[model samples]
Target chain A: MDFSGLINDFGPLTVSGLAQGAIIALFALGYTLVYGVLRLINFAHSEVFLMGTYACLFVWGLFGLDQNSAAPSVGLMLLYLVIGLVGAIIASGATALAVELVAYRPLRRRNAPPLAFLITAIGASLFISELTGVLTHRNQKGVPPVIQAKPLFTIGDTTVTNLQLLIIVLALVMMFLLDRFINGSRLGRGIRAVAQNPDSAALMGVNKSRVIGLVFLLGGLMAGVAAVMYNLKIGVTRYDAGFLLGIDAFAAAVLGGIGNLRGALLGGLLLGVLQAYAAGLFGSQWLHAASFVLLVVILLFRPTGLLGESLGRARA
Target chain B: MSVSEKATFRSSGGVRGWFGRQPVWVRGVVVAVALVLAFLLPYAGDIPLLGPQIVTEGIDWPSALFNMSYYVLLALGLNVVVGYAGLLDLGYVGFFAVGAYGTALLTSPDSVLYADTGWKWLMAVPVALALTMVAGLILGWPTLRLRGDYLAIVTLGFAEIIRIFATSTTTLRGDRGFASIPHPPGEWGGKPIFGVTDAVPYFWLGLVVIILVILGVRNLDRSRVGRSWLAIREDEEAAEIMGVRTIKYKLWAFAIGAFIGGLGGVLFAGEQGFINSQTFVLQFSILVLAGVVMGGSGNMAGAILGGALISYIPDRLRGISLGDTDLYEYRFALFGAVIIIIMVLRPQGLIPSRRRAMELKDREKEVAPQ
Candidate 1:
């Protein structure tokens, strides 16, 4: 109804969308990578991400950081971020590995059907989230806000939170590193080989289990980083937070093409931006609905994903 | 020899044959016994023959019967899509919601949604089915081409969208939901049948629907349509090469499944006396799926049995107390444990379908089958 206000408000919406997209994109990488290698949708990946958030919140609480307290110097904050990132990665990586071992490896060993795996995934997902709920005592835990950059820039009409900019930047840095790792490193080569043809990869002396473990660890690592960044942005974390966010990330993965790494990044950003635009045009309530509507539309026409390969070869 | 001759040979009566060899009276006796047992369950459940601690809390026959029949319909509907056609429709509840609300929209005494049109009770059946079928088509058309995880993602997205729309829309009264949906027209057996009045009518209604659905699906499974569907599920490319229109069969499966789901939705709505989005969450979809899995895929009897088990398990658990401790806190954990145990011990389900048994067994053989 008001064009001027809409125009002025669009700036904040775009920035916020970018930040949200960045976090989703970060989580999407783990999903895309695991799907690429194993062709199994890791339903527990979201829980892995949730574990990261809780790890950060726990660390923050342990440090007794408060919202009103002045942020420690940037160097100290960076050190803390590094430690938090590592802890989150280890915790999430171990959790992912444990799930795979307990729930998945046995099924695979028995040569269980894909449906069996899907069922197991669902069970593991519910168990993880419910366990988290019980462990956290069903309470929302707050993450002491990370303040790195001063709120120094104003683009057009909205005040931007410094934490938002840092999250986006941090996500980008981690993504770049991940891209390099996947596209450049020797382990990445093994991963690609396994994804291309597991039997052949094994024939060629690629350790199948090791490669699978590495993929889970890498994916878990990304989810962990995403958790810290997400906590920093949202200020609070809960066990069920992963459920909605996981669905959104899963949608993004599908939107981009389920197994394509670049697709995950693009899809996450696109979904986030789309949600922000939808909220700006309509309202916040329409956010989830709009994302799904967009997802259905995209999937119907471009089922392989935006950057996905042809359907025949995408089966891996 | 043609396929039809082979099928006939397989179905013919003899000591060597698997199908028609079983006597008709065996099935009749089984059905008769089951009917007697079901009716007699209330007497058995309420009365303790031996001692106070010797017996456990038993399911209320009326409620148990009602739930069993309701879920039987739900599971059968899902089986047509997921088990027979191999389409993982996470948005199955969308059709259910559509049917429930479709009936509610037409039959509601409360204000809103359709202000101009007068209340139409009987018309809601076909209308709900048609609306849900259309919704199924709209959903299935796009996602049919996608397989495996992609199909799952799209369907899940659709389900969430439906939920969000249901929750956010002002016309549907959002979270509060529409209450006091009018009862179905005419009383069963010359008495009021709506709104929890004597579970007998509802139980019979559900039983009749289940019979019809089971027969319909069983016949369909024997038809050319079912063959095409199975072919598609086995291998899309192979099925396509065999001249089966994969897309057409998939869409048909979806529509038929949704139509059945709509039927179940209407029956359920009539029983509840009110319907809302809360009644059709994603977890309900999972519950239906679990029933389908538990009953054994591609088996009508299995689906019904699974449905009955799933529907009754919660109520059965509700009455049990351990040393003055309740099971509410550990309900979900127990639920997860049940699924995992079933999958591990009885991978093929309580009553494995013929095809599913073969498929799973063949795989077992490949991995050193006993």
Candidate 2:
């Protein structure tokens, strides 16, 4: 292992890792939320994020924003960013809802086996991803570089970029708002009730299905935000962009303790930093494997994850 | 077990009922006929059922048949895990890689081991099977404690890890691949047994292995081990309460599944005379799982039919022109849609087993009161 490479690059690794983790944390919230309510993995959440990337890109395309196009002036860039975010959020939320209604709810109604739900989810995931693949011809779409990386500061051979600061800050704000929304709203209370005890929640007039739908909507919105962040940060998006990253995000969710909101944030940041360090010590190719091995080890020791599951609890 | 069971038995009143009503000897004759037709299926392109109007022009029938047989083997193996044992294994391809890499390492001249041992491909077959089974045990031992979807994701992780090992490591050569893998040796009379000139021999060999697997699997399915698997699938808690040794039986299913999947990989290595990470993508595992679910899990015939069609549908459309692009480009998307449609329409599968049919019927009965 390249110990010196890792030790020497610790500052850059932390900065970059947390920035990367922010996207994963946002992405993982969708998986965590749906899992909290439905207790289903919602395999197509990755595709929900996948759609968001394209939706934003397609919106940008409408404004004659090709990859080679020079960045617009400040006002236009802000307008472009706003337009993209709105488009991405709507597209992602709609897709998630459609998946719930079309692919999942029927199985839920029939009380299909868990395996059936997983298989159907796999089908939906593949169908949507492959359709995107066909449309994009399986090519990586170079992001139009709306957000350029400007160096914020340098400390002892480490440089923190503006992009990193923006990603981390944006992610934290979204997470805080979501936490407050879930913990402080009537609908959120309904979600907790349904998650805690579906039968009792129904008896108490919680509108369990609507709560489930609301949970999916919230998850989708977060994924859309993640997709935009990912595009800006990575400078590339593809049909399978959500796929590889989704694996990382899923690992983070599981690491934080699946079905727990704050846990996903903790898991995402820890996993991202750990991965960056591992990549420095080992190689970049080992990054994906490292995350999984970490997941396996964590699962072995504490399957509930670093933070305990809290979707359903007797919290005052 | 009792007269009530026999008296209340509802024979599905359909073509299946008529077919099921036939005497054992007659059914045996029908099976033999079907087998003969299956053996001759590779030549359907040459038969010209409706003359040259049927353009079997682009597809090499033998290769397509080989692909189908390969999938059938995978389906049969996966059926043991997902179908019988009720384990959701999303990373079954990991075992497949273990087998292929095992065989390749032993027989391929490009591999480091080839310089030292230089074993024949056939010699590696048993070693490959054993290696995959051990790998299966290792993976199952830990992850089996988790719940269903959790188990699935862990398995999926295992598959990706295997692929990464094949991709990133210097050992496996990544995408460059191991080439000139020594083919299985031997000849019959004057001709080579499964020669490299045509894939027909490989298909025939695959057929032989598939038949042996079906026979072995059927016997096991009817035995005590199979009963344990069924019990575990039906209700794990109930099975555990009933002294079923759920974990042990689940491990057995997993190991056996690995063995069969590894065997398929070995055959693939032998036929292709090459091995690569690209050949063992995670999608293939999902496709195998899809076959089991779509074909009718818990039924051997259903698995066989499902596996064949899963491969065949794509193969058949390989060269069919669609405006500008070939149909092959759209096959996976179409296949995905097909799987979703099938699961939505008939979650029980096209040819569901008697037990599963009964379960579904019982569920419907419960849904609609008398």
Candidate 3:
């Protein structure tokens, strides 16, 4: 079975898989964080990612960022990308907050059971996807091409796209920042405290609602960044983009031991790499089946997921 | 403890007391009213602005009734698993799919798999039901120990796996579903005796099934078995503490629910005469659940009404043509809004069960005595 060829082909596949994994990790983080506090899968998180992509697209169009620039100016392009990224982050953050406020907060306030919340999440997801489709009036929109880096960076016959490198690096940076937030910051402590025991955290003078909102905000911001990176890599956007992507991220979150932030990142990478290998070994048509099978297997053996703890447990 | 104490009715007439205590005649009137309405519906189009054509258009009362009846059957089936048993089966449609495709493959004129067998079409219904029940047992037996959303997620994966497989099979006609399965035997005495020529007989079939299901579930709920199920739903550990066989009860709930779902799928396959995987999507599962929940969870009447509401709302809205504003686009938005409203305002459902009603009223009484 050509084991050496498969082993030799691993490095390039690893990089590409890692790049896809990073995007999923970012989205998975949002899911895990929200679930950690609310014990509800934020079905709309995929739409948050979708919104971020649209926000970036809107910003790019406003700034006339497009291909066909003969001038080789990396610095200016970087600045433009930064603005677009920031614009997307802010918009997505606001959108996420709005969704929580409109769809979720009331249910939480009323102490509706988890099933109700799940239904609400599904509704919010459908609303946003349909809303996006209605507003954009475009099924597929082109993402403005980023300024290219010279494409000869080959490591063992595997050519890496400059865009792929940027996406992976940025995802890592965001993960690090997230780690610092969850582990090092005062708000992060409150988040952990609330997740551990909401009643105790409330006793400790933490505003539980505010901490949850902040989680959503931070998660939204990460989803926004992911949206930008995803768009840049895939080079297009669609309204119905979030459903499958959202399910995949949810799978990743569960795979990683849902509610564990680092676990989400790890799960995403593992899933991405696994799928890439599956695609390489078999074909792309098997991707969805492979991912679902992987999740079912993991859940069957380790119900708490690979991370061995769940926000679902932490929430109550 | 106060609410729970009040819920314990002391009247010891038992089953007879349960039924005789109610205004039995009132329920009869309600059923009679429905029948009368069914009889009158085809003639309702005679009124102006009401458009007699709406009722006479061959798709009127019978179509709506058939659709509602089919959904009621589906909802009642779903209620057994999700409501009485308290098991969240997200992939319930998988059972439905199995029943549907099972019947189709068995009875289908063109199916290569069963072409040599020459199985009777009616025989396929029972076989499909048995197969789907076995599937439920196979899937449920292993994962029944998982609680709440975990159970929901696993069942959902099972459903998706079944769906993906169903879609993948080009031989079962795959995406372009198997079509033109043999119809059930037609009319006797100018009316459908389990017939296939017109939609009206299907309506009658669906209506009869709905009544039988309602009566069956209601009976089950009142019997020793029903009490065991409710106890399990309320607290499985406690039920087990009291020597109730919780596993048997739960497996019973799941199997019975899948059995009913299989029946509904058979009817669905029979009506359409074509079967495909897309008919049993996750969305349909959600819709089934929405009906069960929006109607009172454990209430048979509520489930029936909820099914009618869910199935009819979309069809009604689909016909609205408002001068370039194609309201069909807003139909799902409206549907979502309705579900949200129902969840927030009336979580107990439209027509709650007798026990639920009494309990809820008692809770209110405890909260603020009248």
Candidate 4:
């Protein structure tokens, strides 16, 4: 229906989509990593991301930076960004650990049925989100203008903004670091072992509990970064913001092969771009519906996903 | 007998055992009496202890009971899928929406398909039920083969799609919804019995539907189909290897569950006389699910109690206050905390199925190695 409009705005839409996709890729790593090792969906992980978004806002608020404030100078902006990122990372990591300890560990010890774990995860998720909702009066909090979206470059009809470049570059750097950490590090081997087979990993003298905790922490850190980038781009955060985005990120993880790291990256980018295109074609109201249709279709046709669930395989 | 066996025997030796020992005629009479008492529950506000405790302060007592009826219906239907069949359907509300929408389209004057006079509520019921069952098959056919979590996400996606479609489509009228969805046809001495002012008739109607659903579900739980569901839930691969047609039973579970859930929706629309996309939020599905899990997922009595409590607690909290804030404001948060606590303390739920309880005990035994 809007072919000509889509063609006209193709460059700009794709650029924006890529920026969103980069953030989604970062957000998706949390789901992929946890699902890889625990084989649980970690429903509370959305609340973990949500906590990061609010934590960063709280930190920025401490520095007297309200939504109406002007962007700071280069040095101060960098300092503020660092402070926000640290606050978010710490908050998200602690929340993830707490969720695991409170909602999951007891069930694990009890050897509770899989349904129990899912239900508890949902409970934990609801508890945090509803608590936040009550505290915030369900209002959307606006982010301070820390870094203004100045055009850094222009190509065709697209003008790449500084914020978008920062988000994309930062996400890539984090992904590269995570990839190396999992592939080249000793701890990464323990993660792979546990993912392949938890019992075998425990038999091989791996501290299964420690590894699981570490996995959660790492995922939380990634979600934290994604949270900050999301604030910078979207400029507002709400208590239930994570609910919809979390679905998209989870779909991305499953789309790329749920247990595979690299696959998450691929899936997130593809999904983001596809969503942008779909929005262009079908109007913005059908944006989420389009993504869901794609998810169902892919699951039906290729349940193993594009990368074939490599985290549980020997190669990963 | 082993220690666990003694405990199980003791647990089953109380009211349930007494009821089991009665003759079939005695059981039938007891059920009839209970049903009669339930029909009189609209006047429960006149009672001393039961009325003051259970009746909602903000909303009328009949309305709350009506709410409980539909919620109980949803829980029982969900119990079939999640409890008996071991399928985690996060999108059970989708069927409810379908049923309501189906009825709305057939009966509401605002609907494009409506004729000179729209269909009666009774006429729309069977169509709504059939549509929901078909919807279930559509959703389940491709996704049931997935692992549990995957199936969950897919079902979640399915509901989200339904909601998004409802919200975005102009034909469904989005949030404006359809109005004048005809109430169930009835007259009592020159007055409409199912009028908007009194929700008691709706409650009775819901009660009747629930009884029918209970009888149907109970029979299914005793048949070969129910046995296959049990086998699948306990172990899918073993059941498949044992020559149980796992897929067929799972689909059957889904279809039946959808039928019951759709029945809830049809009754809901008829009572409300209006419906919109807002009525079918994902949270509604989750609330029903929480009710089932908390009540006793695999037990009919448990599902009924759980469903009633979930609706009742929120309504009961209405107009009550804690210190500075209204208790209703914190109801969902409190419910969430309660869910976490219950799962931690009693993962088998408040009134677990006997077999499920035994299974949990067996699993604990393996873990503890006493």
Q: Which candidate comes out best when scored by TM-score?
A: 4
User: By summed lDDT, which 10 consecutive residues of candidate 4 chain A come out lowest?
Assistant: A307-316
Best by lDDT: 4
Model 3, A1-316: lDDT tens digits are 3346447778777877888888999988998899887777776788888889888888877877654434337887788789879988998898789878876777666555455666666667766777677667737887766656445488877888787788888998999998887877788888888888887788889898798889889889999998888887777789877666776787788889878888899999998888777666645656666777777777778877898555434332
Per-residue accuracy of model 1 over A1-316 as CA lDDT, tens digit each: 3356557778887888989999999888777888888887887788888888887766766667756556788787887787777778778788778767766677766676666666666667667777777667789876665555457588767667777788888888888897777777788788888888887788888888888888888888889888888877787889888877988898888888877877888898999988888887677888888888888777777878888832114423
Ranking by TM-score: 4, 2, 1, 3
| Per-candidate TM-score against the hidden true structure | 0.90, 0.95, 0.87, 0.95
* Model 1 Cα lDDT, one tens digit per residue, B1-370: 3466557646755532453345788667867888676555434545665433322355446656777787888899999998999887766777888888888877776537557643656677888789999988998887777898888877777777788777877766666877777666666588666545566567777777877887888889889999999999899999999899999999999999999998888887777777666777886777788778767877787788888877776666666778875664445556665766676666677777656776787887766321
Tens digits of per-residue lDDT, candidate 4, B1-370, equal 2467545555577677677667799999998999899999999889987778767998888999999999999999999999999899989999999999999999999998897548999999998899999999999899876877778778888999999888988888889999999999989999999998988889999999999999999999988999999999989999999999999999999999999999999999999989999988888888888888887788999899989988988888888887889988888888778888988888888888878887888988877321
Contacts from the true interface found in each model, as a fraction, amount to 0.45, 0.49, 0.12, 0.57
DockQ, structure candidate 4: 0.61
Question: Mind giving the per-residue lDDT tens digits that candidate 4 earns over A90-200?
Answer: 999999999989998888888887777777888888889989999999999999999999999999778999998899899999999998888878999999888988887
**Which CAPRI level is candidate 1?**
acceptable
Docking model 2 quality class:
medium
Deviation in angstroms for B31 in model 2?
Answer: 2.1
* lDDT tens readout by residue for model 3, B46-154: 6698654454232355676677777888899999888788888877888888889888888887677665754666878888889989988977787766666667767
Compared with the true structure, the alpha-carbon lDDT of candidate 4 equals: 0.89
Judging by DockQ against the true structure, name the best candidate: 4
